[model samples]
Target: MAKIKVLILDNDTTSRDILNKSLEESKDIEVVGIAFNEKIALDKMRLLNPDAVIFGNNFNDLSASLFTKKLLEAYPGKGVIIITDSNSKNQASDTIEALGHGAFDVVLRPDPNISDIEKIKFIERNLSSKIRCFSIKKFSRMARLLTPIEETQPYNGNFKPSCVKKYENSKFEIVLIGVSTGGPEVLTNLIPEIPKNFPIPILIVMHMPKIFTKPMSDSINRVSKIKFKEAEDNEVLKTGTGYLAPGGIHLIIRRNLKGELYVLFEDTPPVNSCKPAVDVLFKSAVGIVREKAISVVLTGMGSDGTEGVRALKENNVPCIVQDKESSVVWGMPGSVAEAGLADEILPLNMIAKRLTDLVMK
Candidate 1:
């Protein structure tokens, strides 16, 4: 029942005042403080401990990444929402970069439309809706072509915990997946297979519009025994739970005050052509889990995961890609596979089976 306090961070005075007025007027959100630059932002952050910080990414000058990076080091708990007037392309690219720098969400603030639609209804629907109300849809779709990783391999993948040869180990602590187009269907199929008692946490970055992700996560939780929730800034990654990054925001992994890894959501623009991008999460896990990490890039429509997958591969972490046949759009996964970054390329149907096999081994 408590109001969520928000702090506004922007260099523009008019922008700050407008956001202050808008958030202060809302019953759900309380405007705590406003800052115009990094120095002022940090000062306000120390004194006000707001629940969320609304920062802007669009710049007539330099981007907001470095400032965000410094701000996080000092004030790590405030939920970060990065606002930008970027198109889908630049949004995705910057999203990847911000997550790597430890940002949480890449949010697209509405640009001045020559035509206003009464109010900012679109963003309100996407960013403000309750996500835990929907029914989870069953996994219905299948890929149209080849299936090798599913057929040829048992789940005991090339994973070793104490040694480099075992790229995947049985003692998996977390399941971090980066997905794009057609990801929901793939997840619906894959998540139900993760036992309710599964001992690791699962995190997904399914690139989508912010409005739909909450409902999508809510729907997913309905079918799976695992508790599912849309990620919040600094929320823990407990086992037997699944988290979906809110669309339009980038999700990153961070250690909490308890020293446990938790989620950080950002509202900055997209990185690598998409917010909730694979590149961001994959690259983060490289450091978080090192050899213990398992990065999977499923079907999507862009080359977003290519660089992130490469980072995982270089770290000797096992990187899996949903093969071309199983993917609705192959841009995301295909680039990783073509770059020789994937340790296993599996079909849609057997990805769960193989994962089970690997984790159980």
Candidate 2:
């Protein structure tokens, strides 16, 4: 794996130096450089090309937000963490704006007190535990709580119910979904309400850390009528069960001699800053199911699913994207919708019905 390169931008020489020193000792993170102000950060952004940035939210300007836009424009894939003291309201405003500009997440500056220092110590020492917990929580649920998609087709055999929207035969036999960032929330709303005996099975990819998927799967199963579980490698995608890609791995589908599709997960390096990258699964499924597949791109934080949607469209598979207002981050689904790659764009409230209707002939 390549190093997670990081750059720090803080006017406080003391704090900047301290953080630089701390992360320099990290095995997973590489401290590439540090800057005392926004201008220097921008200059080094192009020069250093770090994978992540830790910016101090204290800007010299009082009325205007800092270089959040410049940073986003310079490096679209770079992750960011804002460190701000509690003293400045502008700090929070800038942080939110930074997220709006495509920062990954935020963190608070730890107090200098011994207790807070001890907490940092605990976290630093338990880094493995934190990563593990997030991974396990990704797909632990077996049911979901949701409302039937309101504006689209219901699970019942309704509408034209044709693959081409004009035929009598239902064109969709497989439900393949791709998501990230806010995927857990999306699943909690859609999976539970899908009625049983719906015939088709669901295959999903939610970009997440390891140990987080199982808990999510368990939670979904308890609330929804259908069963949900993390996809076990080589497990068959069956009816009434929704398969989620395991965290820290790529979940793919392959066909046997009899044309049976089996779900599989592999521990490969992240394809797009995500282990369970939606693109990996979605692209694979397009070849496996072709015109019989119904692909849905849900709320997420990147363009990971966009290319996959393109692949689906090229192969005659019908794909949909979640509409903008319903998306939390709006990056993944938005790109596909904008590219005219998806056949339909609906809100979360209407997605299930649209999907179900596609499946009913």
Candidate 3:
């Protein structure tokens, strides 16, 4: 893979320096330029033409949302990742607004009080991965648009959904969706499409900050027919409602003596470097839901859901993966596809329809 050229925009000297040095350590990324403000960043953007822009927590003139909008308008397809202050009271809401304005992803900046080593470690673990993943997607889009084709199809001649075996039992008790990277934007579009009378309860695991889940769920619920909210501990699973795993916690499924399924929360360390990991949620349902569950792997970075999906497949559960042409970052769903675990590989626009077909049948 080619190195991802990155431009850094930060007014804080110390913070900017740390970001530059930490990112420089990554072999997958190259620091093309560094700007102390958005103006200089814009000037360098034309010259450097970096694959992605990193927006620092402190800015002199524009908010992340405004800057992101400007960047996208000036250079469409350039990925923008915002760095938000962890100490800010409005961190969650601000990140959501930034994403809404077209930012690809957001990461919490380490506290200023933390040691320089700690800050470096934080950036290495969080920000670098986002940049690398975003670059893969950016390049993929460029290749698709630049390469001319006779025709476009979901899959090539040798690829066949019919060749894959799926659980024959038609019964489905619940639906599990695992998404990341572009999850927030995708979920807003998807959840509203499900009708109010949808019979099975849906459990969603989205990679996000702990503070963001409640607001995200609330925002989706406002326009969605099915009730959407952050999951509560030991809450009985209910049909016609969708449950989202709270940020920074694992959502587990357990069956009670009455054979009723409910959600449980755990503060366990992150699996696959993600709290509220898709793998954690999917694996939890292996025995509890068995063949009675249908799982969907949507747009995300990394292979978080592949292992869990394998566990689900072993138990005869059906899995649906979002196709590469429709995913924002195809790491998660792409992994499932490569592993031959997906029963169906459909575009984003078609996922809700297929889901309804499977559940409504």
Candidate 4:
């Protein structure tokens, strides 16, 4: 296996050294270059062509957002992770903004007051793991694109190409979506496209930290014509209102004695290494709605939704997967596509229209 070449960008000498030493400790990672400013970073990127770049908290002269955007524009396939202070007053907003600007991921730096040994351990464990994950995803994407279409099955045996014609008898009751990694940005683009009068409750399971999910919900809601907020335990599900699965807990659907559907937040242990996992939400939806459910798997980094999608398919529920061309990472949706489970595979822009057509028609 080839080592993941990395470039460290940080104006702070201590931070640069910490990231360099920690990342170098990994057997599969090699530090190719270091840059203390945007100009130097650009130069290093051209010269080294590293697999990933780690950006520290402070940029020498450029705004973090601008720098990130410019870097991504210049190096489209290269992975970028921004390190921020965990204790910062603006951590949530900053992290969200960075993600919106196209940074691959964000890592919170260890508390500055910690012992040097502990700080090194923290950097190694957190930063190195993120770098490896990013690099693996980068390589996986390249591999998928390079492989011939004939070698890869583009359409599944169970694939339903047109939901409008195929599910004439199916009454869509709910929209259940599963996303991760690049979810927020995709949601930002998708949620607003869903019109206010669209009549179906939408439940989303996005893998995010406890502090970040609420802000993400707020951010989406601000731009969307349809309202969205974090799911509250026992809240009755309603149409035209999207519910985001709260972080640190799984969001499932259940019925009260009156047979009315409501959101149930579970404290159950993480499934597929993700709390509020798509599987949990999709399974819950399947139990209640069965064939009436409309399951959509969006861009994400893992196969968290594959099993749940399988269960939905078993019940004759319609499933939609985001097309690979429009996905930031196709792992979740691709798994369903590979399993021959999706009813329709559409690009991101077409998904909202299809959802509305399926529910309203």
Candidate 5:
């Protein structure tokens, strides 16, 4: 396989050198160029046409946000990953804004207190993995596939019922979504389409870092009519709101003595190599919501949610999978489909509407 070409952008010479050295250490990645500012980065991007760009926090004299927006608009298909220092003020908000504007992912710079060897190792591990994932052709294809709901099929409000007879008579109390890889983009498009008055609480498990989940929820909340936020331990589950499983932790629902539902965060080891594994949440919901749960497996890179969907299916819960053509990577949803677990396999645009109809009606 050809090496993934990358361009580094940073105003700090030390930072640029660290990233350049760390990234090139991987045989699968090649550092095509390094730029100290927006102008230089744009020129390098135009000349080198690297597969992805590692954008440092400082953009010399230009505005970082403006630079990111222009870079994406100018290059169109190239991926941009943002790097932020741990001590930066409002780093979460900044990272979220960058993601909303089109940056593929965000990685934090190692704390200055760490040893040089540790920092280099951390940078190499994180940056190289992101570069490789972003360079995949499927991601680029999904980016092109994203379009406004109006442009796709109209919402007919006609949805087929679940295959299991138990679900036909049961009322859906919660909506669970499992997504990864292209999740942020998919959520940005799907969440805002859900109306504020829609019934049932929604829980989402999107594979992301500890620092990114809150910001991801905030970004979705800003555009969405229904409230969206990171799930908090012991917080009561409510209708007309969406909860995102915090990154690096497992989110599960539990009932208190009063029979009211609340959120629980687990520090258990990762399942299927995912901390907030979909199976963890789905399995928990199986005991709480039972046949009334509605499960969705969206675009992702692996089969993390397949077992969870199967568990839900065995209990007669309704499962929805994003169709193959609309996904960045069809691993998760495809797994559920192949298992004959999904009740509906629909495109991204129709998901929110179908979900609303199921819960609200």
Candidate 6:
């Protein structure tokens, strides 16, 4: 297998060295080049053709969002990870903005409290993992494009295309969404298409850090007709409103004494290695709304929503997953589709319309 070539983009010499050393420890990565400015970064990008780029938070001339946008336009498929400070709220907001501008992922610089060795380990654990996942997705896509149409057939095991099910009789009261990896770009495109008077509430659990969730919700709210914000504990769910689970915690839906729908937060250990696991939210709706709810699994890196979708399917709820061609990383939705639990496998552009049709009709 070819190593994932990487280019470091940072103005700070010390920061660049740290990033270089951290990635050097990974056998699967090769540091192809380093750039101290935007011009140099672009030059190296054209020259080296690295598989991914690690962009540090030291640029003075351009904002993260603009830089990410330009970089992506220049090189479409290459993964870009923005490094930000964990203690800086401004950087967190900027990171979310970058994601909205088509950045692949974000990683925070280690907290000051941790030791030097821990900082290196932190970068290795987080940054390296994202790059590796991106590499797998990149190569799989390349393989598909390179294969001849006549020679192409669905694999026997986990890669079989899902049989699409039409839910003509489906009536839904609430929407439950789980996404990761390439969620922000998809949500930014999907949410605003929903009209203001649309019925039913939406609960979203996107894999993100705690600080970024508020900014992410705020970013989406600016363009969305519906009210979008972080979920508040004990607040009643309302129509034309979307509530995103606060990161680093579980958001569970429950009924009040009067049988009204409300949300609650759980500090339980991370399920499927995610604090705000989709399975937790999906399972919570089982006894509360039973089959009245609809679950949508968007693009994400892991199979966090498979069990949740399974539980929902058993209760006769309709499950929709983004098709592999539209997903940035198809792990989560692919897992559900491979398990034969998805009721509808739709493209990104069509998901919002399908939901509106299923619920409004």
Identify the candidate with maximal TM-score: 5
* Deviation from native of the Cα of residue 116 in model 2, angstroms: 14
lDDT per residue (tens digit) for residues 150-218 in model 6:
354422223213332345466777999999987887788778878798899999999988888889999
RMSD to the true structure for each prediction, in A, is 17.9, 13.6, 4.2, 5.3, 2.7, 5.4
lDDT value, residue 215 of candidate 3? 76
Per-residue alpha-carbon lDDT of model 2 for 1-361, expressed as tens digits?
5656678888878677666765655676777889887778878888998766777666675211346567666665455556665445556555545544444444456555646345445334433222222222221121121334454444343322244454225466678888875566677778876777677789888875444566557667777777788788888778778887776788888888877889877777888777888888888877778878888898776689888878877777777788766665668888887887766777676677666665763
lDDT of 4 by residue, 54-81 (tens): 8886653555567777887888777878
Q: State how far residue 166 of model 6 sits from its true place (Å).
A: 8.8
Model 6 alpha-carbon drift over 4 Å, by segment: 60-62, 138-167
TM-score, cand. 4:
0.81
* TM-score for each predicted model, relative to the true structure: 0.57, 0.59, 0.86, 0.81, 0.89, 0.88
Q: Rank the candidates by lDDT, best first.
A: 6, 3, 5, 4, 2, 1
Compute the lDDT of residue 300 as modeled in candidate 2. Answer: 73
In angstroms, give how far residue 150 of model 6 lies from its true place. 30
lDDT for predicted candidate 1 compared with the true structure: 0.66
Task: List clashing residue pairs in candidate 4.
Answer: none
Per-residue C-alpha lDDT of model 3 across residues 119-206, encoded as one tens digit per residue: 9988988999888777667633533322212234422323336633344337789999999988877787778878899998999999
lDDT of the structure predicted as candidate 3 = 0.83
Summarize candidate 1's per-residue lDDT along 97-187 as a digit string, tens digits. 4543444444556656623342244444433321100101111123232233445555454432234347434477677788865565567
Q: Counting only residues 3 or more apart in sequence or on different chains, how many pairs clash (N, Cα, C under 3 Å) in candidate 1?
A: 38
Query: Candidate 6 — which pairs collide?
Result: none
Task: Rate residue 88 of model 6 by lDDT.
Answer: 72
Q: Worst 10-residue stretch by lDDT in candidate 4? A: 139-148
**What is the TM-score ranking, best to worst?**
5, 6, 3, 4, 2, 1
lDDT of 5 by residue, 93-206 (tens): 676676776777778888778886787898998778777777764345665446877787776635454353345456887899999977888899899999989887898999
